[model samples]
Target: MITNLIKTFIELFGDSNEEICTFFAPGRVNLIGEHTDYNGGHVLPCALEIGTYALVRKTANPFIRFYSKNFPETGIITVSYDDLSYQEQHGWANYPKGIIAAFQQLCPIETGLDILYYGTIPNGAGLSSSASIELVTAVMLNELFAQHIDMLELVKMSQKVENEYVGVNCGIMDQFAVGMGKRNHAMLLNCQTLEYRYLPVSMNDCSIVIANTNKKRGLADSAYNERRAACEAALAKLQKHINIASLGDLTSEQLEEYKHLLSPLEQKRARHAVTENERTLEAAAALEKGDLARFGELMKQSHISLRDDYEVTGTELDTLVEAAWKHEGTIGARMTGAGFGGCTVNIVKDESIPSFIEQVGKEYAGKIGYEASFYVVKIGDGAREIAEAKEMSV
Candidate 1:
């Protein structure tokens, strides 16, 4: 995946690039919960095998230069770390810029760099591309300066970059998973409290297969904001009768008792949140009990709710989920992450991964005009830094 990074660094820096520092942060797939991060609910996510990698070296000038072989563009921005508003190419360089802004708050930085980045995590399949870049940048700066920032603090700093600088109203899930994910386990994150547990995901002879629908939904889109507003409206309505702050606190009976208090749209939003929370808990229990069928059933139900109530799933996402559902080797399938058009996460038997891929690719393409791309992934480790071969010169 990083063939280009390896090739280009050798061309630009040198064959061995002996002075460069490398870091990686992974994109993630949320298994059972969707759209619940901001609502103080639980989610299950893990780092993918795919990630964004960076190679960095320090510079004497208070300037940062970034190279992207993937985009065929180079970014140059000069600013004191104290004045972090400076930006280069806003598209991809924004992530590194975000980390610079975030880190300046915690550490003293003169803020000049020579960085080259290449990534394998698909850009818009709901796999936290922004978080991947930010974490990689965080690791790079930490190692370059010998700051030795703790991994958890590094994650919080990256989250601040998104929340305060890059301007994405994201929860801690993406950064946390990118920072703390362990091999073969999904991170069970309590987004509000930031307490997490590693849930071992030993899918016996199984793989997490992501079906990419090739439709990108930006969270800045009005519709996504509308969904959030709808959920907030539901919470406001529920608070009058339930004495609860959010849908996370309401039971199905409590919701039924206050059913008519909310408008139809708000009611649907609240219903999805409450049910999704319940399903997440159930799915967690299923995993603990080794009940794949129950977990799978909850996943299917989750997609239906996300499609109908949360109103996030698009036709492509629905079709991919349907294709996976119809497959023999798949235990459960759902449109994962913040949906509209993204990847469908499927729990597939390892032996059937190939046929499942082939059949689903054909079936999804037959239904939709576009062919679905499949990624067979396992949960992997979080952010890591490549120790420098020699002390770098500024």
Candidate 2:
């Protein structure tokens, strides 16, 4: 893959006098702590080995050229530094464009560049693919331009691009995990304070498997924004009676006391946010004590809240989780991400992974009428420039 990416870069832009740099930014999966980031709660997420790869070089011309192997039909997109506005036709390129636009706010970009991108993440599967591309672009700019932007700042900038530029009201967890992930570890992050600690993921004799429903979600078209609005309305109702800023700040007892303050539907929304926050904290503690059972239990509880309380998980996700629960050697299974229809993260005994996949695949297809994809993922490091090779002068 690396060789092909480098070769593709040369083929697209020809030999350059300057050195070409290769950078990688990984996609992220939230092991637990769903829908809690926006509520100022704790989240557990780790970077995955699959993500986006970029080969970049500075060009003499004042025009930016972007190409992607994933979207061959779009061809090479050409834009100037002066014209950084979003265009619907740009498609996947907008992710990188938003990152560049954010960087332009900090410093002047004198020279344009040529970049080739390739991503391994399944699109619209609720994995942090957009964040992967954004962080990759940020890392490339920081190195090539010697900007020296802090990693946390890059994370923030990436989130800003997604929120203000790309127009998704997502929380900081995705960008944070992708920007600061450590190998063999998951981050326990406080979305409000941005305080974080890495917990070693010692899943002895087990593997983390992701089951994709293959049902794509367009954020704008999905009920994601509606759910966020529901939470906001719930919070506002609670604020009038109690002194709480977000549902994350409330305990189960406190929420119960203020239960009458919100509508029945709003009550369910707030309950998921509050309880999921608590579950995430407890799950971290269980992992610290090497209690996989307790951790697994918390994962199950999370899915229930998402399904019953938050009402995000559709039939496809519910079917997958229900099927996973019945399988032997399964520790736990739950829907991850925003959860209209995406993937479920499950911890299963290493020996049972094959049977688990086979059985779940068969059942899901029989019921849902489409095939599902499965991946066994490993936790990996955050974004960084990996290789720098001097181009042979022609």
Candidate 3:
């Protein structure tokens, strides 16, 4: 894959002799936390080996040329280093453009370059493909130009690009996981304080399975913003009765005491954020104690809260989770990501993976009238330049 990608890059830019560097940023899957990041809650996410890769090299020209193997139709997007402003016509390229525009404000860009991109993650599958692209761009520029930016700062810059430039109002979990992930580990991140620690993921007998529902949902246009608004409104109502900064700051007991202060809709929204935050902490403890069963149970509860209180899980995501739950080999199953129509993260015994896939796929296809995709992924390190280009996959 690296050979092919490099060959294509050379063919496109026609600069075989010039120095080219390979940079990668992995997509992330939240193990338990959902819709809790923006509410100042904790999130458990791990980076996957499969993500976006970029082949970049400096150019003498004044304009930067961008090309993607994934979206060949977009052709080459040219932008001047002087003007990195967001352009609607840029489409997917806007993600990288946003990062460059934001990053250039802090660091002085020296020259233009030609970049070719390729991604293994399924687009619109809620795997943080956009975040992967953003981080990869940030890392690439940092390495090529020696920007000396901290990893956490790069994560923040990526989130800023998403929220301010892309207009997504997203939280920092995606970029944090993508930028700071470590191999064979999962990060427990406090979205409020930006404090985090790495927890060892020792699943010797089980595999992490991601099942995509194939129902496309765009975060910016979806009810994501509305849900954030609801949580904010709920927090405001609770603030009148009790002093709290965010929903995550409230405990389940405290929310119950002030439950009457919020409307029914606001009550539900607040419940998910608070409860989900607690569940994430419990899930981390379970993993640390090597208690997969307890961790799985927390995952199931997280899905239920997302379905009932959060209302982000649609029929497609629910169907996948329900089917996975019925499987005897399944330890726990839950809808991951922003919910509407994404993927479910499941823990399945190594021996039962084949049967689990066949059975779950059949049930999902029969009910949803479409086949869902599955990938057995392994936790991988965060964004960095490959010392030597290599093939990437699960």
**Structure candidate 3, residue pairs in collision:** none
Candidate 3 residue lDDT tens string, 206-309: 99999999998898989999999999999887788888878889999999988998899999999999999999999999999999999999999999999999
Per-residue lDDT of candidate 2, residues 1-394 (tens digit): 6766778888989886777788899999999999999998999999999999888888789989999998989999999887899999999999999999988888888987999999999988888999999999999999888999899999999999999999999999999999999999999999988999999999989989999999988875778888889899988988898887788899999999989988998899989999999999999999989889899899999999999999999999999999999999789999999999989999999999999999999999999999999999999999998754333211
Q: Total clashing residue pairs per candidate?
A: 0, 0, 0
TM-score, cand. 3 vs. native? 0.97
Clashing pairs in 1: none
Least lDDT summed over 10 consecutive residues: which range in candidate 2? 385-394
Q: TM-score for every candidate vs. truth?
A: 0.92, 0.97, 0.97
Estimate candidate 2's alpha-carbon lDDT, on a 0 to 1 scale: 0.92
**RMSD score of candidate 1 (Å):** 2.8
In candidate 1, stretches whose alpha carbon ends up further than 4 angstroms from where it belongs are: 1-7, 13-18, 73-83, 86-89, 387-394
lDDT of every model, 2 decimals: 0.80, 0.92, 0.92
Ranking by lDDT: 3, 2, 1
Q: Give the TM-score of candidate 1.
A: 0.92
